[model samples]
Target: AQSVSQHNHHVILSEAASLELGCNYSYGGTVNLFWYVQYPGQHLQLLLKYFSGDPLVKGIKGFEAEFIKSKFSFNLRKPSVQWSDTAEYFCAVMPGYSSASKIIFGSGTRLSIRP
Candidate 1:
């Protein structure tokens, strides 16, 4: 079955730590990949996305993700993570470009940062 996978269930780090979160999908056709972050008491926000152009895309707050078509993966990365980066990250995939198409979200990865 087509699905998005996030292998990491939880991650712990201190301030100024680097982060890499893995995301992979099972769909065989073209797909739009996204990473959404939700702070402890805030709504989800779009961290980054990949559709048709260059596979590497940068998002807000120094966050970025690289889409690898061959591996069916779009992994999120941050050079240095701060306490503010602690949040629940979700990897989502849309099988097609249609706005009506439902986006499948991977099981979230919870990140905790020590002060």
Candidate 2:
């Protein structure tokens, strides 16, 4: 079965700290990768996505992810984080198979920023 996994459940860091979260998937076919973020009270918004070309995708707020086909992974990274960056992080993927077509999210990572 096709599935996506996020290794981090919770991450606590100070302001301006570098951040990296692990993400891996098990799929042999085509797929669409995405990183969605829900800021404190904000709704889930697209951080980035990997559709066809370009393995390295960049999103808003200095967030970016690299889609490594060999590793079957797409990990999120940020050089510096802010207090406002605190939120829930979700790594998701949509397979190429034709079904109802749904976006599946990782349990989520709760990020806390301490000044």
State which candidate has the highest TM-score. 1
List runs of model 1 lying over 4 Å from the truth. Answer: 97-99
Question: lDDT: which candidate is best?
Answer: 1
Worst 10 residues of 1 by lDDT: 94-103
- Per-residue alpha-carbon lDDT of candidate 2 for residues 35-98, written as tens digits (9 for 90 to 100): 9999976899999999878899999999999999999999999999999999999999898676
Clashing pairs in 1: none
> Model 1 Cα displacement at 50 (Å)?
0.7
Model 1: per-residue lDDT, tens digit, 1-115? 6799999999999899899999999999889889999999999988888888998999999999999889988999998999999899999998884668688999999999999
The TM-score between candidate 2 and the true structure equals 0.93
lDDT of each: 0.92, 0.89
Instruction: Count clashes in each candidate, considering only residues at least 3 apart in sequence or on different chains.
Output: 0, 0
| Quality of model 2 by C-alpha lDDT | 0.89
Give TM per candidate: 0.95, 0.93
Residue 43, candidate 1: how far off, in angstroms?
A: 1.0
